[model samples]
Target: MSNISVSENEASSSEPENKNSPAVIEESPELQRASSSTVPPDVPSDEPPDAPDGGWPAWSQVVSAHIANMISWGYGTGFSVFQLYYKQTMNLPAVQVSWIGSVQIFLCFLVGVASGRLSDGGHSRQLYATGAIICIFGMFMTSLTNTYWQILLAQGFCQGIGAGLVFMPASASVAVYFKKNRSFAIAASGCGSSSGAILYPAIVQFLMPSVGFPWAVRICGFISIALAIVGFCLLKPRELHRVPAPYLDLKAFKSLPYSLFTAGSFLVYFSLFTILIYINSFAREILGLGDVKSVEFVLVTNAIAIVARPIFGFLADKFLGPVETFGLNCIALGVMAFGWIGVHERIAMYVYSAFVGFVNGGAQGLFTSAISSFVPDVRKMGTWIGMTLGLCGFATLAGPPTMGAIVDANGGKYLWAQVWAGSTIIIGGTMVLISSRLVLRDSAKPSAI
Candidate 1:
């Protein structure tokens, strides 16, 4: 591990003399100079700090991170296939069946603090290696389980924790490597989720009927294993200035922008997974689509995301800036939520899926890059992101089951669920707009809050 350095501009510009005043500084050339200077000492000074931005090492890391993203996020995002399968095969209530997917998402966010802290402490590779093994083991165990509890422990809890460990570190590493094109780099890595989304559902659809559930799941597990190994070899992080504190900075809430941003993230996630989890079921139960056709809804949504991610990333970098882009995308997501109410016919469903998928990909893919802009020191990024995401984890935990209860109470109609999802996302979008205003107002003096 190499020592880290903070440029004079970054060190001097990070803090405000007046505690109550917003730190707004001019967007000077110094800011750009300081950005690359924050890299660890091991990077050669002769080569442009942004060299690896397109160079093989940087792209290789992105590719590995993409693989990890595909394995972790792909499974969680496409859990609808399994959800529909459980509904038909198992004698469980909708609420009980929803727990498996909910728990998987919950642990993925909840473990962020620990995993991020570990990465900040220079344990990134170890965490990724351990996570890969745990995730592979969980998937293999899932294939062997017949009971709900067994699957919950193996697939939901075990795999979720492993995925979190892999994802957080991989995300943090990309920030370390790219400063000028950070959003685009992160977006490129994030496309793996969309790719997984495109491939996994189709794989399950083909495999489940031909080979049955156990083999279908095991085959996915095998694919995850191969990807994880390659990702583990490629993913690397720059050394930190120092190890981060074991505890989360509760004082981070004092920053108005950060507080509001976290709140908005929490609210957005409250209904975020609802569509992904239940869209296939909605098509089958509400729209009268066949099993295969219903699964295609998931495919279409994720497939559109593949193209949308890079476009949004480019827009974030070149025009809107990450915070603005994220807020605007959130608004688009809210509008698309309303579109879901009209999705009765096949054409309407596909249209809604494509629009929502585009917006959702932009919002999610740009999230980490947006947050990174708030940090003054890249060394503490892992801790800040972990704590913020950990707070949002509760929303992921509660959202699905609450929606399940609402659907059950309404006699299986999706009207109330749509209302819940749309209203929360709209509110979340408003919160993000407020945060963006704070960022814009304080743009003159850039302080990593």
Candidate 2:
């Protein structure tokens, strides 16, 4: 006991000298002591290094940031040009040719769930680069293919993979970057698709006659390379303390409002792409318009949609809630689908295009906003969105071929397909409308009551 007490006293006395001694210093002991210490770091006061603040990206920054996405969407419009190729060049039956576009659209969105997860994991840039490279390769490969199967593999699968990589990340990034004006930001992101829908077809038409399909496709491939470059340079994610989100969270879909909204999204996209894929062909053959006029009709709708998306998004945020706006737009789209039943002349086609573009644009912007509302927990949104989009991807895959089959069964007249599409729009619109009403009712109820 006397020896133990004397040893303790000697150890305590040596502790101060050991801490002060530099010659016999060891890192682990000092680290252990530092961990137990309550005092903070004794460093000079200065502004800490941090990521650049993104306070509502400037107009030029906004456009520059979004341009690459727009070009990607524009690249998708190349499928519309395929309508002309199938009908005029390949001389394939409408039903058979429709599969190419349907498969492409299906694959693009189908892969979005996986891509969304990748983005959440801090690998978006690599995923995007890989997609662009694959898509460019597919485009060049498409120019060389003659058979339907070859084109499907190269254009549909490979190109579709590229598109899938770009879509969700590009869209979700808008939500991440802009909170104050989220609707407008989403609308801006959407411009890429709209521009792609319009410009690609028009450009292809101008070049296909003179340069031939192969060279035209190659030109588009080169353009995609440029697009990918810009995207890598400018499309940066803002650094934030992100809680890792599940890539596929099914439980979030249990919310009734979100379920209904997702159902409506599936219906809308199914019908939307069906019309987009078939409209140019319908305008040319069924409506008896010239090829140039038919393409112009398609172009006009996409161009108008660019403006309408931003305008309606603003209205949804400012006046109506996202649910209300989605319902209204769905209703308008139904009306436009019905109007298509009577469209034959160029003038009527133009009117129909403008109406459909306006309504569809609004619906798209509203749906993105509404989905986020239901899954208010930020960390869970990516996973919830992935599941919903997966469902939507399945629908997009089936819609075009199914519509084309209807046209074929009806002796190459699109009237049957048109009626089916119109009915679908009405049903989807009603679902969204009922859901919106329920949301409004809930919001209006007084807490005291």
The prediction achieving the highest TM-score against the true structure is 1
Give all candidates' CA lDDT scores.
Answer: 0.77, 0.66
Candidate 1: residue pairs that collide: 24-444, 24-445, 25-444, 25-445, 26-444
lDDT of 2 by residue, 1-449 (tens): 00011143354332211232432212233222211110111211111123121454423334533554554556664476686676677788777787777777777777878887777677767776777787789889988998888988988888888777766665655555554355566666667678777767776777888998888888878876786787666656555456666677776565565677778778877787777777788888888877777788778878888888889767655556556677778878877777788987878888888887777777765566556545444444445566777888788788888887898888988787988887887787777766655543443322210
Which stretches in model 1 have alpha-carbon errors above 4 Å? Answer: 1-26, 29-52, 444-449
**285 in model 1: Cα distance from truth in Å?**
0.5
Alpha-carbon lDDT of model 1: 0.77
Distance from true location, Cα of 364 in model 2, Å: 2.9
Best by lDDT: 1
For each candidate in turn, the TM-score is 0.89, 0.83
lDDT of 1 at 60: 78
| Total backbone collisions, model 1 | 5
Candidate 2 ranges beyond 4 A from true positions = 1-65, 441-449
